[model samples]
Target: MISVGGYYCSGRSNGHHLQGVAMVISNRLQSSVVEFTPVDECIMVMRLKLAFGFMSLIVVYAPTDVCKLDVKEMLHAKVASVLDRCPQRDICVVLGDFNVVSGCDRAGYEMSVGPHGSGADAGSKNRLLFRDFARSQKLRISGSWYQRPNPLRWMWYSDVGNAAKKIDHILVSTRWRILQNCRVYRSAVVPIINWLWLPSGSISKLPSGPMITLGCFPWTG
Candidate 1:
């Protein structure tokens, strides 16, 4: 299985680009496509009872603008449920705009600014949960730096400079052998031609081949 993720910052100024992405991706995948949620981000999430092993994948886009209290809570709740459903899953990959800043895997790709507050209702709570959940499941967060587009300013109505941090990620479960960490690369991109503005030469090219798999050979254990 393969997973793709990108941030759709609700800047609301980029509706044209979002529409383009939907069209291109939809046309490429199989007609058996499935939607995993009532939300915009979801995976095909097919189950294959192969002779070798079963395969499952989940694609999630954490609620945008996480400074919003309700959105943050909704993300944590749904994420916990999604992981709970697949424990020993063979090939599980979770990717998208998590909008989370703290919580790095032990291998150390994510550089978390030490959360600066105390209490059950502060920034620390987010860091604590983000780290704890991944560890409890034996899931692996790619410890290597994956490419992410530059982050925009904090969306909160308040100024918390340190709160600004990376939110996109590519996480895989404990099942697959990571043949090469190099497969995960972030596309450092600038939108030169937005199709929404110009039709002929306005389309931006997505960087080719991030998170590559050698082949879709099934696992048997």
Candidate 2:
């Protein structure tokens, strides 16, 4: 099982540039690709889950630097709300372009050279919240276990990693043991990336990352 998502951040207009709004993947979550007249910037979250029999894989996505603590809380809450409602007969895989960083607890350094010198203070508290939440829920981060720049994606911006960080992720539940393989997809020319798991068969990361056509994500169980 696999899932993919693209989040549209209501980030300052300076962060993202766009003309009109359209094609909302999850209107129920109040996400939009375009802002309607002085409205809040739209946001999106995508998840992929591979269930041996009945497990669920949740998609993950978040806006960049949401200052209001209450809003941040709601962001996490809404994601949790969706995941909770999903069936738990199988394991879960939550991942995607999370604007914030979550703390990791597996072992040593996961991503070696991010070009951005550790990205420590870039949402340290939010990272802690994720770390604590993962501990409480028994979820494991997939890519980190490798301890290498496992899946390197090119950022549209400069190589400073300033425009990018290991913000995207693929988190799985502990119960799902025998499964562990993740990869990043990037276009030979495009700087953006897409994350894939179970990574077998016809998948390559040499630029031209995982080319996903239908932008819409799959529904998890």
Candidate 3:
């Protein structure tokens, strides 16, 4: 919970400190926070009081693609339950590392995925599951709707630095066009993906508000 200029909320597994997810809200926006709930080790929900309406931020870190089918199904079910509990009028956002390769195919999933996704693992099991979940929930995969450089496209790398893949995603309610731009910053020091949103007006430190940029970076202990 080391957020220099913000408030940090994290959820960790009982014996696994590295297997969890966290969220950080800027100090300026701290007063708008309504409640924070750690659904489990891998999922967290934060509600905020915004100018226009309420907002729900569901941050998650799903299991790897190699995990068992039941495990992946359970994760998606939990996430879906969380979304269902949120108010229908609130601006809902789900973002984090899904650890599933979402390939560059927008034929059947045009409403969920966009045209600017990477061309790897086109119809992987995890990819289909992810896309189907998005479609079922009527959420748009906002991160894949932009064209970025090759370096900025991948979010994870292999131990030997020989392979890389894009496993991070930002899903927003399809009814709202709040996502302005999404970018992945792969740094040698700090690896983070930033999902920018310009909802209506400006905030204290961000460009626009109601909902601002949410950075779901990993904080190792």
lDDT of each: 0.37, 0.41, 0.74
Predicted model with the maximum lDDT: 3
The candidate 2 region of ten consecutive residues with least summed lDDT is 212-221
* Model 3 / residue 65 / CA error / Å: 1.3
RMSD of each: 13.3, 10.6, 4.1
Clashes of each: 2, 16, 0
When 1 and 3 are scored with TM-score, the better candidate is: 3
**Model 1: per-residue Cα lDDT at residue 161:** 59
95-212, model 1: which lDDT tens digit per residue? 4445454343333322322222111333555555555555555455442333333332112222755444444444566545432341212232111111111112211332323322
Superposed model 2: Cα runs more than 4 Å off:
1-51, 103-118, 121-123, 150-164, 188-221
In terms of lDDT, the poorest run of 10 residues in model 3 is 188-197
Provide the global lDDT of candidate 2 against the true structure: 0.41
